[model samples]
Target chain A: MNWEFILGRSLSSAIGSDAAVFALAAIGLNLHFGYTGLLNFGQVAFMALGAYGLSVTVATLGLSLWWGIPIGLALSVTLALLLGLPTLRLRADYLAIVTIAASEIVRFVARSVSMRGVTGGSFGLSGFADEFYAVNPIPGGSYGFGVVQFSARALWVIAVAWGLVAIISLMVYVLMHSPWGRVLRSIREDEDAARSLGKNVYSYKMQSLVLGGLFGTIGGFMYAISQQSVQPDTYSTPVTFYCYAIIILGGTARVLGPVLGSMIFWGLLSFTDTALRQAVGAGYIPTAIMDGTQVGQSRFVLLGLGLMLLMIFRPQGILGDRREIALDAH
Target chain B: MPTDTWVDGVTPEPGVAKPDPILVVDGVTRRFGGLKAVDVEHVEFQRGAITALIGPNGAGKTTFFNLLTGFDRPDAGTWTFDGRRMAGMAAHKVARIGMVRTFQLTKALSRLTVMENMKLGATKQKGESFARALLPPLWRKQERGIEDRAADLLARFKLDNKRDDFAGTLSGGQRKLLEMARALMVQPDIVMLDEPMAGVNPALTQSLLGHVKDLRTQGMSVLFVEHDMDVVRDISDWVVVMAEGKIISEGTPDHIGQDRKVIDAYLGASHDAPTTPEEEQRQLAEAEAALDAETAEREQLQP
Candidate 1:
């Protein structure tokens, strides 16, 4: 077994592009679920829209890449308003139902054959990331410390993705510490009480929806640019659930939670996969018990068991105060 | 006893006009599908007095409070606060206009620090705006001011020691105090409390009553819904009695206690005022026997 290769591969995934994408996406989910106590099960829709927003604008409409930013933001905000205006004033469960259904709707429409001209059908649009790559200043070369080497192309994307994560994280930190974030947290605690105190509960909820959706939009942008494609299957229900897992694992309501959770989640998965494959190749585990193809399925089972144990023992997640997240949902 | 009389020379009556009225309700009514939950008509609150709204369970006292405060919309009618038309305004808008209220079940924002809960009550917070929130330098000084104000209010409520603690950790009575103190942070002209003493311990009842009295002394009107006749007689200068969603009697606390209509609504008409001392003793003994029988049955069930 090549131990050096396994360790290096694990390190690469721990802070790689996939981790960066989830970190950004989970931050948005954190704002919705953690800070605001909003159940937004359709976060993947915002991300999908972001990816398609940019790729379609450039690849299909033939517009400059810069136009996609505002277009993406507008699309996500519109979706948030559409979902929030009616449901936010009612029960919270309504929003959850609407969001999960809406996300599925977004995915289905993007992949349908009727809109193939615009969304490129199931195959999705590609070759729209040229402008995104053109802005990269790093020279093309595989550069890193020995075993943990990264190609300049991958490193550039990682740098931009993680850089965006850091900036957004700081913004969240400042806002959450302020009185505005207090109102959102107060709403999470009790909507009627916050309303009684004269905070416009509906408006705050709408704002939170839009702001969190915007984060998902940016995450989409990163996902699309990193992959250089916008496939419908890539933005599925599992995507949103993965973001949920990342936030819960990191700790809901903490500024750095999503980032920390995403890193550890991807890192542990990568470590397990690499170790299992190496062990299998070296005959550490016989084929009758487990094989190369089974490793992919087995790793997730391990992750699921880990998550279950964490919830039973520490439901508050890494950074959360048990008292805060342990609220009886009204 | 609130020696200063309210509306001198005005006859003791339901919906009697107050000399210095602060809240004027003309015909506010709310119906929960065939059942008239609140049908208050022409009730006026004294500008700077502590008034008690008393009734039996399901008498629409709480529903009436909800309508007046804009928590629930009225089917028809118009009311005003300090001469401002308030019938159609939103609850938060109503609060901004200085009429703050508390719930029967205390909502202390359990996850928030006690101090954070207090600060949330203050109006016109610059940092509360989304754009202004991003820049700390703009709101830091104002935040410190609110922190100090919250600290002072906490101290006044005897909650200063638990300023940084999560409100979830507070005892029931302490949560009630925190809720009341948080409402005061808004600097409301009228403080409406729905069953402020319902879940409170007997030990804390005196302190709660004192706080309600202090509201009047500080020039704020207090309209509280309470079931305790003793508390009503002790703290409220005036009383409004409700039964089946309608105002049945309105007068000084002493007068309300003697009103025949109010007595009938509370204890049923068979509980006559003309009963002799011997008959009253017999009735009291019968009630005690019924209670003893219930306890015995409950203990038997457990066994």
Candidate 2:
């Protein structure tokens, strides 16, 4: 019921490690859907590959986390190429279907009992983040302001995660302004026109898929490091949907849209959770009207309604140009 | 006419053979089911000249353009650009070989800025590499160069102010101009335009014609499909007439305008009409009689 506690937690959640990870993943989605007009609904598959790649390498194979990181990124790139090589030359909707299915397949494979020896089955992998934490520069002690505090280890994770997000954001910004980026946007708008101009359209689409998947894998790595564990459930279809929501909320194709969107999305979820729980505990609403369990689920319902409204009123999200969002080209 | 003449004092030198033709199509046939949509036998596009391929709707003019430019595959035929066979090349590969084409329906990238659309035309340039993208200085310099070229094209097309605007925001005529300007950014060896004047405003038609003329003046070959007889008559140095799927007649614009087969084709005469054996024999005799009469008339007129 404490307002100060709720506000502090909400603000920190908006800018915390999870937000950074989601923002990075959404940036990759922005590249795929927002800029390239590729309906890649399997972004989480890349993330899972990254997480599993790192976890299996380090924990199961007894390798270092450093070797695992690059391996994860390489695997994501390979996945992108494998998915893009055949499908990009076909209908774009094929990509949407393949990606969604691929991510689910990845999840099932990771959680399958047959792979228990290597993947730990549903229990997932832990203690693989020790090497990462051992390199943290922050000293011991919790630090923050106004009831919002993070322990030294948490601060270190946040620092690295947010730093990666910032660097990737800057890279996306500069690339989008370059000639190659211009070609990508043009292909999104009119691929036939680009082809008439001598662009290798299929090659460009493949490159974009690989690049975006790499970014998604980076987000997966951060998510694993932040939580200090790697689990199949963490990279589910819902995770991809959450990235999509973040991109839509921020504004597709805008450089800072994903970051801002992730912050706002997580912040709102935290605020609603705290406020609803507090209101129910204080008996501000009758139990017959809304029970604690019911209140717990209403936040997502409200969020869904908000998303529908945003799509109806401003399909371009908060900052996107309407013309940029209106993709008439197949 | 001051130059050499064909039959009946028709000027031939102005539209006759040039030093070299930029594009040659030989026996290109495109069939849709049983119907041969394009059955071009032989056609030549003169180097450094603007040639118009004109026919009424459904006469396969667009289909012929599509086949030559790699938008559609030919069932049986071959095409050459500057001595290189281009029969089965993909559209983009054809473009990379210095041949580019516009669509009958404008295909401007709606989401991109006018400038960005123009930049896409320069994709074959060296700076589009991933490594170059990471190194700003190397690619930045190239990007500015492309931007400068795009800006110049925009100015030439009188679309300079709209460079920053999304291509979809432009009017139909403006989009057409943007498409043309984008093609020029590639500096193609030969540019094929499909219905460049279709749906374009009358005021803009003159500018479009001027641009076509300028392309020839700059030593670039042009092959355009047009329905506007007046524009085709004015700008086209040579004209090829298509009917059903074949080049029924080809010569100067004046010659094609008055060709009897062309008139029959445009008037919707049934090219596939069944002919009785007796009727075919009678027609052959009539054709012999006409040929004799035409030969005598031509000899008298020549003297």
Candidate 3:
């Protein structure tokens, strides 16, 4: 059963470029759900916009990659404003409904036949990352520690991605500690209390939405650059659910929770997939039970089981304190 | 009590004018579909005095408070606070303009530290701004000052020992105290309290009343809604009574206690206030008619 292959795959996946992407994405989700009680169910839409905003600017509009970044960020901000305006003043569940619908709209529109010429339709887009890689400062070679390795190009992406994650994490930490964050927590506890105290609850909510969506936008950029592609299907409903799992797995409201959670989530997923594939190949398990491709899909089923167990056993997550989670004053 | 007796020798009536008014409401009306919730033609709150807004259930007292504080928008009226045209302003803006209010259901941020809740109440916080929040050096000194003020308030409210604990851990009475102390952190010119003594133990009600009076001593106007007659009488320099959607009377607590309308609204059956000789005679005539009918029936039975 190739223990070496299994451990190496799991270890690399834990800290790989995709892990960095999920980290940024989950960080954004943490801000929205954990701290502010904003139920942003369509985080994937923000990510998709980030990807498309950059890709469209580069591939369709023929702009530089640098210009694409700002455009993508602005698109996310506009999306946040759109979602927050109608629902934030009302009950929070309305946002959850609006966001899921928003993500679906983004996906369908991107894949539509009329937009194919611009968005590349179902095939998605490529050749946009050439400009991104052209600026890579890394020298061409293989880099590895004892257990995990990557090509120079991959390593460069990983470096930039993790660096962004770190900076964003630090920023979240600082912001959450500030009085501005205090106001947000207050709103989460009771919107009327914050309002009566003279806090502009609507404005603060908008700010949080815009700010967290910006992180997801960055996640989109990293996803595009790492995979060297932007596909509508890649930023689907499952991606957001994965983020929710990661946040709950690590801990909500804790700054490092998502970051650590991302690493562990990807690691466990890889570990389970590799183990199952090997078990099937070695004839240790019947093919009728599972084949190689089926093994790949079964990892998610395992994730569901794991999530259930976590909810039952340690719902506060790794870093969350049980006392902090009692949003229910009862 | 009003230092200058601004209420003395003044006309005791609905929509009465005060000598030095801090809040003035004119033609304020709020209707919920078919029901008129509040319809005050004019009402003025005296500056630096404790004013109690009293009413039974659904009296529109709370609705008027909500309109004045910008929590609920009035349909067709305007109000002025501290001489500023404040009608239809956002609740936060009203608070920024030195007027703040509390909810009937106490809204203490339960998950936050008691100290954190107090700091949130302070106004003009530099750290509250998004751009400035990231720079510790920019807001750190100001934050420290806010902390000092919060610490003082926590002690004053006897919440110092529970400063680091979650606000939810506090007892009901303590939550009410914390909410009031937090409201004071606004450094407000006036504080509107909705049911400050609600859900509070009787032992703490006295202290809460004292705090309301203390707001006046600090030169801040105190307008509170209360059902407890004793509390209203003990603390309020002036009393405003409301029934159904209109101000029925305004006077000292002593006068409000004796007003025929207030007594009827508070104690008498809302629909049956008539008690006169003419009404008695009508009732007697009906009884006499019933007796004559009964005598006719008895004659028939005897035959």
True contacts kept of each: 0.84, 0.80, 0.82
Q: What TM-score number comes out for model 1?
A: 0.96
So what's the TM-score on candidate 3?
A: 0.93
lDDT of 3 by residue, A1-330 (tens): 898889999999999999999999999999999889999999999999999999999999999989999999999999999999999998999999999999999999999889999899988998798887888899998899766889989998999999999999999999999999999889888888898888999999999999999999999999999988888899889999899999999999899999999998999999999989999999887988888889878998997898889888888898888887664636
lDDT of 2 by residue, B28-146 (tens): 88899999898877666777778788877888988887788777889998878999999999988988889999999999788777888888888556567776876778866777888
Give the winner by TM-score: 1 or 2: 1
Ranking by lDDT: 1, 3, 2
Fnat for candidate 1 (0 to 1):
0.84
Q: lDDT of all predictions, in order shown?
A: 0.92, 0.85, 0.91
Quote the lDDT for B72 in model 2: 81
RMSD of 2: 9.2
Residues B1-303, model 1: lDDT tens digits: 775665455677998888989999988888899999888879999899998999889999988888888899999999999999999899999999999999999998988999999999999999999999999999999999998999988998999999988898899999999999999999999999999998899989999898999889999999999999999999988899999999999888889888889999999868755378998888888889999999999999994
What level of docking quality does candidate 3 show? Answer: medium
lDDT for each residue of candidate 1 in A198-247, tens digit (9 for 90 to 100): 99999999999999999999999989999999999999999999999999
Q: How large is the C-alpha RMSD of every model relative to the true structure?
A: 2.7, 9.2, 5.3
Model 3 over residues B1-303: C-alpha lDDT tens digits? Answer: 445567776799999889999999899999999999999998999989899999889999889988998889999998899889998799998988889898888888999999999999999999999999999899999999999999998888889999999999889999999999999999999999999998999989988877887788889999999999988888888999999889999999899988989887877556554489898888788889999999999999995
The lDDT leader among the candidates is 1
lDDT for B57 (candidate 3): 92
Query: What is the DockQ score of candidate 1, to 2 decimals?
Result: 0.71
